[model samples]
Target: MASASPLIDRHGRTISYLRISVTDRCDLRCRYCMAEQMTFLPRERLLSLEEIALIAERFIARGTSKIRLSGGEPLVRRDIIDLARRLGRHLGDGGLDELTMTTNGVRLGEHAEALADAGMRRVNVSLDSRDPEVFRHITRHGQIETVLGGIAAAKAAGLAVKINMVALKGLNAHEIADMLAWCADEALDLTLIETMPMGSVDEDRADRFLPLTHILDDLLGRFDLRRDAHRSGGPARYWRLAGTDTRLGLISPLTANFCDGCNRVRLTTEGRLYLCLGHDDQVDLKAAIRDGGLPAVDAAIDAALAIKPRRHDFRIAEGSAPAVARHMSVTGG
Candidate 1:
């Protein structure tokens, strides 16, 4: 069999992962992602399932082997199941080594089985605080029980589940130990993420941003933790609780910039491709698709890939205003 051509960027890094936002519509107004009340994109502005799949096909043909479906809230999209089935068909049975989705878990209970059957191999569910009231306070929506039930349903559906917890100082930072303990018992992968400066969360409030290093220090005194064998894909760095097989992951996006090996690219629901999360540089593939031919579309993609920044400068520098000011919900988190 002929080897698939490598999709290397200007820096010579192989790009194999693609994150496609199915819709920029999400149910929860998480304090970190959006304001208490904000306008969402009109229905007509979002990309259709067919358009998303067509882009995926083009990327797959260019050696992308992994694809993850994300959304402001993916499950909220009426025909999400159909979208998943279509993406699965394009990826084929094992054509793409990995296919997954990241969700807030609001609608997973009803959609888990269908998603798994449609060839989604694993899922990453966001659960920042296990405390119901705290969860509500952070997300502005008190749906903790529903999210937990969704996690249970996803696990029961035989999907590899990873719990994503965004630790905020004075908020859910104290729950890290407890979160890890629960994940250990449930046999789930726990990822602790530091807050980013992009959302409605004020820059001053971002000072309360909890770094993963502090969490590690706190855990070291409580449990024996050891760095685990490194994995190729995904952003988090994995480590195991010393005595058990249960593993924990850390995403210190604020402090640690993993841009040198950024094997992934993000496509907004509306057809814009962003090279980095912290910067506003994006390519408008949707307009190209409508106005230009396939060559034009591919050229836009290549241009985006060529200009992919060496790394996101979030430390010494401030965040840039996005070329498209659509919030995380519209851009697909």
Candidate 2:
């Protein structure tokens, strides 16, 4: 095996963002993230808190500053607050600049305060539909009331809350305006994400896939929104709702690929590190941790970074590329 390649990728980009999936278990079965009959990963295969912290420590030493805990639903994992505490300790003395999480918000109302106290800076809650019935239809078991309660609790806990909504055409497209209006009222940052053909969802259901451009155009027609200067970062395009403190973001990963400036690496619950969203290539850090030590784990991460593809070719025009088998839930957003 080749030795570690340090922090730089093949394109010489510095890797700083680390997205770690704590568990492959989620309460809801979102149509886009899991098959009808899902075979969740067994318990033994999941990475322990210690193992996760060790890998995080190694990466922090190598210049990683931002860490985001993700999952099939991060809150689904028992004692996730403990994992957050351990990670917070490892990231002491400004080692990690920011610690965040993305969840479906089913358990947020119960754990939000504890998570905020444990050194988490913010949270991004995935809520695609405002209508309770639509939410249930999309996520099989999700309760809009519970998610809303979670969002309120997160806000009360003092953690910066971002609401992520995937704007599917026939599914939740009509609710974009309402969602944005609700965000404005609640003073929460709302993000509209375009659907991608990367999960178990029916690819032929093209009607459900609404492009970001269309969403933006519709929003502009209805609201007096303007581009916000302060909220710009990563792939999310920010816009401020006129006369309100709330802001909106558009994450057009499919319509506008920001791979050139991409600086993130995703770690699955099973400990596989993926360099890109559209690629099957990965490095097994869990195996290294079980067999070797921190040095071995670092080497695996570095090798993965080195092999990180410059960009993903989704083949928009041809639409012939193979779909990404790892659902968004398993990969932890």
At residue 54, what lDDT does model 1 achieve? 73
What residue pairs clash in candidate 2, if any at all? none
**Segments of candidate 2 deviating more than 4 angstroms:** 1-6, 90-92, 202-205, 230-233, 315-322
lDDT of 1 by residue, 1-333 (tens): 123345788898888898888877678878877777676668787777877777777788778888888878888888889978877875564457777899999999999999989988789999999899999998897589999999999989998898988888888988999999998888888888887666554334444578788899899888778999867387888899866657898888777777787898889888899887777788998887778855667888889888888787654233444223446665555
Q: Tell me the lDDT of candidate 2.
A: 0.83
Full-model lDDT for every candidate: 0.80, 0.83
Screening candidate 1 with a backbone cut-off below 3 angstroms (N, C-alpha, C), the clashing residue pairs are: 26-72
lDDT of 2 by residue, 1-333 (tens): 222444788898888888899988788888756766778889998888888878877777777878899888898888889889877775567577888999999999999999988898689999999899999999987789999999999999998898999887788988999999998888888999876667655444355667889889999999999988663335687889989988888888778888888878988899998998888889999999999887778778878977999888653323343367677777778
Q: TM per model?
A: 0.92, 0.93
Structural RMSD, model 2: 2.9
Query: How many residue pairs clash in all the candidates, one count each?
Result: 1, 0
The window of 10 residues in a row where model 1 has the poorest summed lDDT is 316-325
Question: Best TM-score goes to which candidate?
Answer: 2
